[model samples]
Target: MCGRFALTATLEVLAQMFDVPERPNLAPRWNIAPTQQTCVVTQDPSGRHLASMRWGFEGPNGAPLINARSETAAVKPSFRAALAERRCLVPADSFYEWQHLDEKRKQPWRIGMKGGTPFAFAGLWENATDKAGQPLQRFTILTCAANEYLAPLHERMPVIVAPEDYARWLAPGPAAGDLLRSFPDEPMARYRVSDRVNSVKHDDAGCFERLAATALL
Candidate 1:
């Protein structure tokens, strides 16, 4: 699942990339973690827009972090309603995944679009409110079995959306099943990076620098 990812592109770039108006005060995040406020693009009864959504699915005080499994999201209670009515496009420059190769040598990999174009992740969001009657929103990324290039590192990966399918995925109505497909393997590229990314505090461009395994950490 896309538990952690990067959104280093500018708002204008994202606006053009997603074809939506930028949300004022949208900051660029180098190491976005779950439960944090992150940007998402969606459509509603009014029109398409960009908005910030809390990463982890919000429920009770200790709601689980069960990011919807793309393979079964359409039927799951936590995501069914949102899947049908509140789909979104989660744009990311790249995502990190770790592979446990040996007892002490777990390697981290950064995956991005082949030519560095940003990609969209299929997501579901819900409108929830707190006891104080304040409005709150939460969302989760959908994941599916990993592609050949990623299977060796992790068994699953986020469902990356294709450019042509963006509108259909965010379009109002029954389009979940069709938009839930996995990204084509050809357009994806992967490589190893410094393990500094292993720490959430190490949020910088250096964290994304490619490095030899011997020099990592």
Candidate 2:
């Protein structure tokens, strides 16, 4: 599951990358965790737009789900309707994963595109209402089996949307099922980082920086 990730790019950079005219106030986030607000690009009856919505998936309030497995999202009751009706693309700089070598040993690793281009993660969003009649929008990242590059770091990875496929993924109306496939393995790179990222309290740029030689896991 993608419980934590990073979004450190400036608003101007994201605007240029997404080719959108209006820019929203976006702060750089290095340690984005579940239940936090996140920037998501989605299409409505009007047109395509970017908006901030909560990260964790909360449907009918049994428990918060951070991820929806792409393999079974189409059939699962919790995700089946959303998968077929409401789809969105979540942009992120990179994501974090932990590897376990033994019961007591787990190391955090950072995964990003090779050239550092911002990428989109395929996602499903649901619109639910709170007791106060306030609309609550929640979303979950779609994950597929890890590839050669990410297999060593984790068993699953977000479905990274290719730049060429951005429009198809964000097209209005019915959902796009083909975008749920796993990302190509050759376009990503991963490196070890300090265990400092393991704590949610460490919410700074240092959390994503390369670990020192002596601190390498």
Candidate 3:
């Protein structure tokens, strides 16, 4: 599960990369936690634009489900409708996963595409009401099986939508489901980082401090 992640790209850079005109005054977030509002790219008749959506929607268990398994999202009632029509792209620079070094030794690793280039996670969004009766746009990141490079860390990883497939993914209907495959391991890299990322309070560059040099070849 992509419980914790980061999006450090500037709003100007996100605009250039996504070509979206909506410039919400969002700062660089180095540690985005669940339920926090962040940038999400969604489409409408007006064309693709940026939106600020809180992570996780109300799931069947009455809890905030921030991640969904791509393989079964289509058949799952909680996600079926959104998967069919409300697809979106979640801009993220990197994500974190924990590795079991031993029974009592778990290490946090930051993973992302090589060179820190920004990318989008294939996501599904839904409109729902908050406890106070106000409307809210919430989303859940889709996950697929981990690729060879990241399998040792976890069996699942967020499904990153490639730039070339952005249109196809946001297109109407179930055709977009095919784009949820695990990203290739070659263009990705990972390394040990400070465990401060485990906290929702540590939302700065210090959370990215390197603890080890491990990375993909």
Over 1-217, each residue of candidate 1 has an lDDT whose tens digit, in order, gives 6768998888888888887865568766777887778888988677778888888776556774537898777787778888888889888999999899899998888888877778889888888765598898888898888888788888899988888888889888886586676677787888888788888887788877886754322
Error of 2 at 207 (Å): 0.5
Task: For candidate 2, give the lDDT of residue 68.
Answer: 92
Name the runs in model 1 displaced over 4 angstroms: 59-66, 130-133, 213-217
Give the lDDT of residue 55 in candidate 1: 86
Tell me the alpha-carbon RMSD of every candidate: 2.8, 2.4, 1.3
Please provide the root mean square deviation of candidate 2 (C-alpha atoms, Å): 2.4
Runs with alpha carbons beyond 4 Å of true place in candidate 2? 59-61, 130-133, 214-217
What lDDT is reached at residue 99 by model 3? Answer: 94
Candidate order by TM-score, decreasing, is 3, 2, 1
- Model 2 lDDT, full chain set: 0.81
Expressed as tens digits, the lDDT of each residue in 98-130 for candidate 3 is: 998999888999899899899999999999989
Question: What TM-score, over all chains together, does every model reach?
Answer: 0.90, 0.91, 0.96
lDDT of 2 by residue, 121-207 (tens): 998898876659899888899998887777877888898888788778777666666777768777777778888998888889898
Scored by Cα lDDT, where does model 3 land?
Answer: 0.90
Model 2's TM-score against the true structure: 0.91
Clashes of each: 0, 0, 0
